[model samples]
Target: MDPALLKAREAFKKKAFATPVIEAKRPVTSNQESGKESNKKPRKSAPAPVAEKTFDFKKYKPSSNANFACLAKIVKYMKQRYLDGDNEPLTLEDMLDETNQLDLAPRQRQWLATEALKNNPKVDITEDGQKYFYKPTFPLKDKKSLLRLLDKYDQRGQGGIPLEDIQESLPNADRCIKALGEAIIMLTRPTDKKKILYYNDRSIQFKVDDEFQKFWRTAAVDGLDDAKIEEYLEKHGITSMKDVGGKNSTPMQKRKKPTSKKPRNFKKHNEHMGDILQDYNG
Candidate 1:
């Protein structure tokens, strides 16, 4: 034990003593954390409300009465021109001038001229340069002659009259001819055969009656056999012959016939012969 103890003491003396070690120090807060907290993005603000634009239509309202009055005046002037035998077609400028002579206001004159051109085919506008001119479409002096010519064309059922002839007849012949065409189309349609036979937008359509319908069907079927006719009649519930004709009629009378009789058998000889034989045997 002494020897082992001495060896242990020697070994303990030769061993080096260890010093306590310290870890490298670091800051408590990280740059990344600081940056995240400091540089957080702000929320976006809501958009502002936009102002709405308003439109005013009152400034553009048109007067029906004024327009009609202007049109009437224009028609009167055109009628006069037609009577004067000025067959040259009138333009929008001519109409505006006429309206001015009538003492209409600037706006009123323009409105009237526009109305006249719109309602009458005898008025037209020409873009001669930067501005447009108004004039009659025919060679006639005025509206009355225009009306007469229109009536004549309508009665005659003619359309597309020559522009030169119209101009020669009325100064505003182009418009007149167009108006006449429109009038004829409106007044003489096929539907207006009753009360008024002619209108711009109507026509006369004749109604088909039962007889006509029957005729139509018969014509359509043409050359049908008895069986085919019977099938048609049965399918259509045409029970009686009169039903096919669409009316009732008298029953057909029976034809007279010659009378005939059966011939009688006159055979009494066999019975008499049997009686004679019986008597001979007895």
Candidate 2:
């Protein structure tokens, strides 16, 4: 072999024997570990799903023989079971079987479970980490009982019962409230804006002149506080129950006697001054 060929072969051998530049492989980690490694932030667990307060009935078509009013039948069955002291959570299959709805088609069954039964106002559904189950919303079955509850709350002077509570108790709460007409006063709470239902006593509901109502509504008391309003009313020969009871005096706070704090003996200089100077010098 030529000298040049020999030198080339030696160079090739040297190159082949040289240390291989292998890229360092990062150790594999789990999804949770990888998330922490990448962002240096602990992964936030998903928020638990909140239950819906209301269901839109318009989204579903009217119940017919097709679905066999599966939801209504189930509600009735559950309520009966509840009254009989059997308040155990019933499965969809169990509800369907009980309500003679096992013969429903797959799509219809799915609809009944996901939409109909779950959205029924009379049904109280819950999931126990394993499977979803159903129960009755409340023990009271009729609008009369709901009205009685409202009357009881009103009589007790506990402000007004929550509309959500009424809805949860009564199956046809909207219809019942509508049928009640002016017999119920529905007011929206200022804080959360949730509707509150107050029972109206027709015996005490005296008719007021339209002009007086207009005057009352047009009167702007927006900037006036209760005290200012009361003062103004008193000046005009109008006295409120609050004024008749007399004003309450503010309780005076007792002044604490000067605590004899031992006069912080003023040292002419800091005790550690020499030590501090020595440390700085060193």
Off by over 4 Å in 2: 1-138, 161-165, 178-181, 187-196, 237-242, 245-282
> Per-residue lDDT for 6-71 in model 1, tens only?
998877766734445589977657887889878998889999999897855445445788767767
Query: Evaluated with TM-score, which candidate comes out highest?
Result: 2
lDDT of 2 by residue, 82-138 (tens): 555466787888777887878766677677767776666666666552224434344
Candidate 1 is scored at a TM of: 0.25
Q: What would the TM-scores of all predictions be?
A: 0.25, 0.38
Q: lDDT (0-100) at residue 114 of candidate 1?
A: 53
Residue 18 of model 1 has an lDDT of: 46
Where's the lowest-lDDT run of ten residues in candidate 1?
193-202
Cα deviation of 39, candidate 2, in Å: 49
